[model samples]
Target: MLRRLALATLATTAAGLGPLPPLPLLAPAGPDTLTVTIAESGHPDADGTFELSCGDKAGGNHPARDKACERLERLAGAAEDPFRPVPEGQPCTQVYGGPAVAQVTGTWRGRSVDARFSRADGCEIARWENLEPVLPLVRG
Candidate 1:
């Protein structure tokens, strides 16, 4: 199933369409990849943009390629979307994590994703932690 998405073949099968008219590969990493960017206000060295590919073999410029790739694969198959933002109006602690922020944009499990992450509050902190190595680990 994962490979199918990389090949851009799952859209047809998963959607009951006999065949998709060939989706143009989104980038050189193919359609099964994500781009992660992290930044810390006033901390230039702490920012970076990485590419992660979880297809035939784990390959990319991410600092933790293997772990990040595996984490994404697991999240892709999980019942809940790991990229989902915390529910609105949900109670969260007032704790302030830090100035770090991140974004993950690309395709995953055959779906498009453009999730933003931060450590501004409890819920945001938890949300940032969910993607683990995909984003940088936050020390609290």
Candidate 2:
């Protein structure tokens, strides 16, 4: 009965007609999700993970998801690199602002971001500062 009906359906499908369509995939729990982490080099207490989401509705563990998303959107649109590399042979002041490191992973505006940021030198410090509010500048 049931078994025969099942076999008949399977046979019909395999006979010549196209196979059944695949099931629809479920939407993600949230769009534009990001996992952000910041740590002060050598300081374990300052490290923590923040989950964020941005889109028509912005929300997540991040304290300022809306602002963070706004900054990220701006960064994505900027002609200059938000995390521009320091040009070779260009001398920068020997300034060690503080060894703060940040990691941003996940999707933003439907694009992946697996960027690490650090303030090891003047150029790096400038890059980190540009990402501020999104990745807060750590002071020693």
Candidate whose lDDT is highest: 1
Model 1 scores a TM of 0.72
Model 1, 21-118: lDDT tens digits are: 65665434444688989988345644789888888888789889899888877876675588998898999999998889898998887778899989
Model 1 clash pairs are none
lDDT of 1 at 120: 85
After superposition, the stretches of candidate 2 with alpha carbons farther than 4 Å from their true spots are 1-30, 41-46, 79-91
Q: Write the per-residue lDDT of candidate 2 for residues 32-114, one digit (tens) a residue.
A: 78888988655564477888887777788887778887887787677444544567887877788786788888876554678
Residue 79 displacement in candidate 2 (angstroms): 4.2
| TM-score of each model, in listed order | 0.72, 0.63
Error of 2 at 26 (Å): 23
**What is the clash tally of candidate 1?**
0
lDDT of 2: 0.73
- How big is the positional error of residue 93 in model 1, measured in Å on the Cα after superposition? 0.6
